[model samples]
Target chain A: MKVASIGLGLIGGSFALALQEHVLEVEIWGIDHNQAHIEAALARKIIHHKGSIDDLKNFDLIVLSIPVDAASALLPEILHQAEKECLVIDMGSTKNDVCEAVKNHVKRNQFLALHPIAGTEFSGPKAAFASLFNNAMMIVCEAEKTDENLKKKAYQILQKLKMQLHFMSPKEHDKHLAYVSHLSHVSSFMLGKTVLDLEKNEGEIFNLAGSGFESTVRLAKSNSKTWIAIFKQNKAEVLTSLKEYQQNLKEFEKLLETNQFSELENLLNSTSRIKEILAKK
Target chain B: MKVASIGLGLIGGSFALALQEHVLEVEIWGIDHNQAHIEAALARKIIHHKGSIDDLKNFDLIVLSIPVDAASALLPEILHQAEKECLVIDMGSTKNDVCEAVKNHVKRNQFLALHPIAGTEFSGPKAAFASLFNNAMMIVCEAEKTDENLKKKAYQILQKLKMQLHFMSPKEHDKHLAYVSHLSHVSSFMLGKTVLDLEKNEGEIFNLAGSGFESTVRLAKSNSKTWIAIFKQNKAEVLTSLKEYQQNLKEFEKLLETNQFSELENLLNSTSRIKEILAKK
Candidate 1:
């Protein structure tokens, strides 16, 4: 199997490496808008060769793992240029826009809208690893739109990577991700910003921050370009989630301000059920 | 050395375990208002004996690891019961109130206020581990108030656990912690609350949530009884930190609402510097 990995960053590079690791016979070609990323991916052996979208005939699978905006922008054309047997899989965070981009295309059957829910706070080819998708959740959006054979091909590869697959519509995917993923990113970024602004002493934060602070603000280190594209493409859902989150914070503030200790404890205890929810994972 | 661990939960139990692991001669006695905790600690070998604060005369060190409210409530009397060379260390999150409560006490020189910057989302004796404090930060407030000899004894135990110690005034410790530690816990709890409220389908959150969501909301699982007490004790500082955090979130909302993509990206990029700050930890 020959694969083309678009945008040689964490997601794309990791997928390329995972394929090479799990699939017995696999060849991955790296493509990135940044020359540095291409060079890094090649040096890291994440890909066998540097390739371009124009050379699509040589590839059996194309993984689009760029920012959502770029993924949407390039999806239709990538699908247009793909051969009948070539599977074009998108691994972007936002599903609806890119799925919509190629919805009416003639080669829609060859396109798979995928969102493998795996990542680290770090980015770029240097941050990639082969086991990134192992035991990770993979959301397959609009799977019915893909041809049966291509869907089977995608599933086989996902199975090789040990990904747990779930199906959801593009809209549902966006809504749920806004709450579970994107909103958490926003909250983490804001928490980091607030602390940075208020605590002028970086040394103090360095000395005082515990594992809790590290984990809570970990997502704040996510790539700005990638997240901005996501927040933009899924604006409505993201806004709704953020509004609810802000309201909760406001209510938390009021409880503290008004000396409502018991009510505050109630709120915290209820939310602590997240422990059980996550423990199941 | 004889150590009495009051309120034998995560911190207290973990400390007792660490002492047993690192110190050559140690006998630990447990004391908790909750009989079940005492039983659990004894069963888990976190304590050798079920003891009481009234038995402080039998111990060389008394560790008060309860909620801040209880620590403040009982600190003075515990100090009053301590022998001349006995050290009574309060290991609660908030330091100001507890320090204030014992400020002018007759045994002020025997009481030390400590805040170890180490913990997990889980609590209780079941979660206790000897290595919990290894390579973790320890905030030592009002160290100068403690007798030099007793402070040396406290330092020896902390050193045995491999804790990095930093000294500051009680006021300074509470203020810094409100931003770095307390605020993160509130943000995490509220993030969990917002997601739980919005994503009615627990299955969706369970399936779609990634490592990012897990880390960001990890602190939500912290013991609510413990957090409420800390928040109450550090009310003024925590409120100020929350106000700044709320303001930052509102600004973030405005940026996304007005389509200020560049500014949003900048905000994210700036906060991403938290990566560097935390990496120093």
Candidate 2:
């Protein structure tokens, strides 16, 4: 089988590597607009060859692993040109926009909207790892719109990659992702902003940053281009989460102002439920 | 030398372990109001023996690794009864209140206020590790209030543990820590709250929680009691930082509302400087 992956950066590059490692007799082809990323992916041996859309006719599958906004804009064209039996899957962060945009495409049944809920803060081809998706959840959205054989193939691919699969609608995926994924990036970015703005003395921040601060602010290093696209794609849900988050902050501020140590402690205790939630997962 | 560490939980248990590993021929004693903690510490072999305040008189060094409020209330009494040359030090998250409470004590010169900028979200004796302080910063505040020889001994001990030493005034340390440490806990706790509120469907959040959310919300699992004391001790500084963070969020929200993607992009881009700042450390 030949697998062609577009936008061969972190997610795509990792997918290409996973295919190479796990699948027998699989040849991986890569497509990326960024010349540097393509070269990096090639040098890193993440792909067997670099391919163009013109080569889409020869591949068994094409995976779109770009930003959501870019994926939404490009999916129709890619779907229009791909062969009827070819499987096209996207590993974009947001799904509803892409699904809506390609709903009417002639080859829409060939496309599967998937979000492999796995990533590191680092990006680019160099950040790809073979075990990046191990034991991670992969959410497949709008599966009803996809062809049965393609869905089976996609599930087999994810299973061989050692990912647990879950299914949901594109609308549900977007809302939940805004809370769990997109909001985290914003919170981290804002935290970095808050700390940077308050501490004019850079030396102090560097000197005093412990593992807690490092872990909490780790996602602040995420690429702005990708995050902006995610935020824009999931704007309404993101906005709602942001409002609640800001309100939580304000409530915490009021507690601090009144020296309500008990209330503050109670509020913090409520969030400790994440430990149980995370532990179960 | 005999070392007694009060409050044998996370910081104290780790410090006792560090003493066993680093300080040659030292006898370590554990003290905690929680009988279970004391029993757990002994069972885990985190300390050489269990003791009470009666054993405090026999130790060459006495370490206070309790919550800030408890430390503030206990330090003066501990100082009043400690030997003339006994080195008393604390490992609280906040420094100002504890430093001030012991400022005019008769044994002020024998007391040292230290905040080791190291910890994980997990706590208790089981969480103790021998190399917890390795390559981490130990901030010593108000060094002038400490006896020269005692301060030297404290520095020597911390150095023996392989921690880098940073000296700052208590006020400066509290202000800086509010940004780097305290604010991170609050941000993480609130991020957890926001996600937990929105992710009412358990399976969705479990499936969708990528590394981004996990990293950003990791600190929310920190001990509530310890953080409440920190928030109370550094209330003013925390409030200031919280307000600034709220303002930044509001600005970002306005940008989203106005479809000002460029401004939002710039905001995220500017905050990415934290990567460099953290990288330097």
lDDT of each: 0.90, 0.87
Query: Which sections of candidate 2 miss by over 4 Å?
Result: B201-204
Q: By summed lDDT, which 10 consecutive residues of candidate 1 chain B come out lowest?
A: B198-207
Worst 10 residues of 1 chain A by lDDT: A198-207
Per-residue alpha-carbon lDDT of model 2 for B46-87, expressed as tens digits?
A: 987888865578679999999899999999988887888799
lDDT (tens digit, per residue) of candidate 2 on A32-95: 8888988999899998888996667877899999988999998998888888788999999999
Backbone clash pairs for candidate 1 read none
Candidate 1 docking classification: high
TM-score of each: 0.97, 0.97
Candidate 2 recovers what fraction of true contacts?
0.89
Provide the lDDT at A138 for model 1. 93
Best by lDDT: 1
Error of 1 at A135 (Å): 2.1
